[model samples]
Target: MSIEPAGHGIEADNALDRRFSGRNEAVPDEAHHDGRGRFYWFLIGMRGIFSLPALILMTSYLGFAAFALDVGLTRSEAVFIWALPAQMILVGTMAGGAHLAASFAAVTFSSIRMMPMVASVVPDMRNDKTPTIVLLALSHFIAITSWVFATQRLRHVPRPYRTSYFAGFAITLTSINTAIVGIGYGVVSAFPPVVAGALFMLTPVYFISSIWASARQPVVKIAFLFGIVLGPLFAVIEPQFDILYAGIGGGTVAYAIDRVRRRRHAAGGV
Candidate 1:
């Protein structure tokens, strides 16, 4: 890599991006396109289980095990709903004697945040031979841990191996987490809510850190800022919808601000 004078903030970030984008010339592109290369990267991706985010996620699922037990759900049910927070709401609503339609509506609304996460990561990982079906299949594994893990690492990986790399990491992470829940399922009575709650708290703490590290785009930082400001405010106003409102409202505001900034910069007015 060429050495250059350092820049500040976003300028520094762009410099880093310029430094890494397609710069992995240690192996030729053809090598990565082959079965051997894909397998190698897949194994490399599996190493993500040792990462901090993966560890945090694994720890959090222990809490989820307790939650599942408390809710009278089977071990399999806990693993099923663990990925989608909205489904947890569905369980809670149905437990409260809510109608099926109402429970389904709540799950649908809570799931809206997943759309952007899937959209943002897929294009960057795609190549000429990558099929739409494969991408769609892989989308099921795209969650907070995998998204953050993959986004921060994908730029350095070869285009052809990106999907395999993601699959390795995501599948490994998911499998281990599932195992954690399964093993902890019948043992939740000994775990206690206080212990479980403390363990679950690691997720957001790592989430904020990981998001900040990978948020090179101005919109991402803007959204993070707005989320921080709006989350608690909305929590007090309406706890149930606080997450929905804060996420949508912050992202919308951030997107608008980023769009305006880009336009101004493009027009040479900044």
Candidate 2:
């Protein structure tokens, strides 16, 4: 319910002790803060390898764009129409410079959201400048998959090992992404238009799967359901505003339901 500034140095505190004990605690050694074993780290690293398929799927976008280009669409023309308008708006806001500025802004936003995960791992690092920097740098690789695995699967490991295991997982996944991007770029260039078009489905499939897998809360579930139904309806009226309408509308409905449920439960004294 409240937010606090993330600490700079690891300190001996009761709060830190409690952080390792909660039921939903992400790390195993919440108390000791020691990292996991090398073998365990290796297994975690395997998760990184799984990133290849996901990254390959992502690269399908580039392929689809190329296909669009080959079919007589200009690069800017295709991007302006097919890509999210927010992207175009961002570029337009950049004072008539290259659209890469908008791309950088989007990345910066993602990085800002990523800071909390990095903060969660910071306490477990070895209390030295070099190790801290190394861990922080490696933390960039921590994505939803690694975070979910770390929080759900690795919580039983000792605290000392959790950070190391996560680091291994992150490092491997990063390598997988790097490799897939390079491969996908080359593959899309060499493949036929139909094949490239087929590959573009990978992005939507990946996103659908991820959303289905990660929709844990009742609010999220309801919002997703409503979004699916209402999205197209709103798109018919105003395409660019569909997501905003569905998200805000569904979220409002979900919040009201949750509020009423809480009130009823309180009245029932359950």
Candidate 3:
């Protein structure tokens, strides 16, 4: 096997990052043709916006909005937080009253999850000739919720329309959830403190449940288990850096385990 230089990997990641940083609304007219057309897939995507999991996702965001209000963020601020991709960081910063630099560091570390997620999903949605800007815009719509839906739904969607389909699903979900955040912030004051607290826990609980239900690979399952176990421990040890530590530690251990398992299987097969 041939090994690539470190610079090659850096250049590749830079290219991917650049694709997402730029903004473009138009998809190229000339791309792969899959007969069903982009609009048909887009309609299919719109149909998926109301899937049961999406309802659950809304509840989670509702809980988050209430939690943000409970922590003293104004209604507008709570809604503003929902607009950003760095949910965990924004929540942590607000709850812990951390400084901007610390919040930035935590958010950057946590966002490592998105890199692999985008890399995995984008190739399926776009061909080599798909405009980089269009690919970038679609990638921005990819958070944990939409990523799960996109990966599963794309199997049935024709290749050419996958991008448009994801666009429809993602945009619809984002728009609805953004509105729900505002609604939640407004209504939270009416509920009892205990109920409001429970609402605060809803999003994290839903996220864990989703991961448990969706994981098919052993390594991913292992990583998730490690994260679950290590999360509380690290939170106690270092509250602000808990997620950063758990993610890195859990993922590294899982990767090592997977590598060994693969090697053993290869040896046995040989």
Candidate 4:
């Protein structure tokens, strides 16, 4: 019912404990106030609609929508493509006259990045008591930003409220993205080409910056670096299959490097 400053939840919880617990009484956990906890976190998630993560997602979808419009896709088609769990590369293929099978393949391949995210995040938020349908449904919301945000913040969130918090965050993010995609498509032609170019460029720039800001693991950093270096080169060599080849080669190289580094460290010298 009330808004607190960011990062104040722990302090507030401590204060609540001091106020509520007597000398002989044990402090109640967050789940003891499950309804309030979920409501509070849900509100927090909804309030974060204007934050950087949402902005990045909105800009990226905007760029995609604009491109789809330019390539003669109808508004409904554009929304349909955006709604699909595919990356922008699949949409690019569609725009470039690729067949249905090729588009599906590219989309599936592009989505492999989501696998690690799913494997890492779901277990943290779930328990044996959690329902199968809940896990299955929430998996759809496990994109890059949501995964990063949830991985960090859910540690502080109560077990019972994590799913509710995430649902609110994901819903707010996707709703804004869906709306912006339509807006971008409608406005792309209304603006000049120079402006349109800048708008479209926002997507890739935001994506790279988001990754650069969030990546901490050595293997991930190395993989991203190799991908950046190899992507253009592979594009030049064979444009059609560039994403697939670059991802495979870059990931392999990074994994090899990481294994070598770990082995050396284990031997007590690196």
Candidate 5:
């Protein structure tokens, strides 16, 4: 006779149940769901004021200034000659055909990674399509830092709110990025090379730090470590193909390891 969890309607033999049982415990109270909601809203509100200014100043001073140096222009010359024109083009092109094309490409590429996340959360959403599409659209706003933070710090949030929380996070980040790009053009000339370099380091450093902090699963750790070690080696061989090779190579390795582990566990149980 088949057995099931009493009153829960879930079968005892459900693979999903087994997976959840094997997963880590929920996040603690200091990182509670309600507190995270408050923080998320706070970040959204801050985006219009403090975040925008900081982003603009940093991007202009760091990214634009660094680009200037790379092209052998003095800071002033770079700002006036290169940065200004570039900013103008970016802003102007936002409503142009190229911008639309780039946006479509970005959306298409982003959807590939996003679909898995949506699928994972679909049950939690009770198969609600409206919220799913809305959240998917909102996901375009997400960058590495917010994703890491949301995944690590907001474990208590019900599945439905996770998308909304991510939406808020992405919106805040997008505003900050836009503001930074705008401000960076004007102020890049005033910053010294060292200061500019520091600014340029922000995005990369944040991404690395977030990944290190958020990666919990053995499979993820293996994939990431392998990707890191193999990425440069492959890049040296063919820079354009490095990412493709690393993803396929690392994914295959991880899948093989998982398969072996599962087989051993099944054998042991038998």
Candidate 6:
């Protein structure tokens, strides 16, 4: 792929786009890409420092580090992984003497949630000139916060700049959180259960607000709300599969409702 030159004005950007626009076949990502583009997006991505999600994440992880201490983990072990769920599962398994196979399975299932998030944002972030490998590497950094930010904000960014923008943001966020975990490990270790629980709740509150803010379609909104409401009822009836049941059952019902609505709309329009 002929890498486009970024950090230039809009006219230069447009010129590069026109020059490369006709090369339709997929090319290796950024084989010829340069430092200027990377630097530009790095600056752009670092803006997350002041974002609400980033602040909330830093606070939540501060609380989570206390749990890591309880699990008998080193600061290095806790800082090694970025995803909270994966870190929790792997650390818990290690502490509980769970086998490698079981730990792997649990982590994979936790990662399954990332697939949809990656699918939604990555394509828009990539161009034909982008390397598939870059996309793959960037996918590793896409937790719920990054995914939500990218989906909601990246579309407004120039397409060619999207991947770099994401790389910068994700890298910065990861680095900051890792530092937070490492530095605050001892300080937060003695946090009481109530305070830790409250800090943990911050992440979910952000998730709920973000999902609501990002949902453009009524059907999508209904599915999210359905899952939220069904969760408690399902928990009472079948605790083990409450989340699974709430998710799949709610999604299936919402999908069916959407199809019927579409059909009715088609018929009524005709």
Candidate 2: residue 219 Cα off by (Å): 2.0
For candidate 5, give the lDDT of residue 80: 47
Q: Between candidates 1 and 6, which one is better according to TM-score?
A: 1
Off by over 4 Å in 6: 1-38, 192-194, 231-249, 266-270
Residue range 1-270, candidate 3, lDDT tens digits: 111221134544553454444223124433435545677777778777677556767776776776777787778877776534586566768589888788888777767778777887887688665798998888888877777676555644545567888887887888888888888786745767787667556556756665555554578778888999999999999986787678778889998998899899999999
Tens digit of lDDT per residue, candidate 4, span 45-126? 7766666656656766776776778777788777765443475667678778989899888777768767766887887686
Q: Best candidate per TM-score, number?
A: 1
Per-residue lDDT over 17-47 for candidate 2, one digit per residue giving the tens place of the 0 to 100 score: 5445643554443444433355566575565
Q: Write the per-residue lDDT of candidate 5 for residues 1-270, one digit (tens) a residue.
A: 111121122322343454364343334322454756646645543442343223433454346544545445444454343223234334334434466666555445434544444443444332242455675675544333444444443333434344554555456555554455445544556667687677667666654544554454456667667778888998998775676677678767976887788789899999
Backbone clash numbers for all candidates listed:
0, 10, 0, 0, 3, 2
When 1 and 6 are scored with lDDT, the better candidate is 1
Model 2 spans with C-alpha error above 4 angstroms: 1-39, 51-139, 142-163, 226-253, 265-269
Q: What local distance difference test score does each model get?
A: 0.79, 0.51, 0.70, 0.69, 0.49, 0.75
Question: Please, what's the RMSD in Å of model 2?
Answer: 10.6
Q: Model 3, which residues run further than 4 Å from truth?
A: 1-36, 68-77, 83-112, 192-206
- lDDT score, candidate 4: 0.69
In candidate 1, list every pair of residues with a backbone clash.
none
Provide the TM-score for each candidate, comma-separated: 0.82, 0.50, 0.69, 0.69, 0.55, 0.78
Instruction: Answer with 1 or 5, whichever has the higher lDDT.
Output: 1
Best by lDDT: 1
Return the TM-score for candidate 6, rounded to 2 decimals: 0.78
In model 5, what is the error at residue 181, expressed in angstroms?
1.9
lDDT of 6 by residue, 1-270 (tens): 111122235534554464465244124324424678667876887886567777888898887688788888888887886788777888888889999999888888767656766886767688877889999999988987887677655654556667888888888988999999998887897778898788788888877876676565568778888988999999999875676778778988988898899899999999
Q: Rank the candidates by TM-score, best first.
A: 1, 6, 3, 4, 5, 2
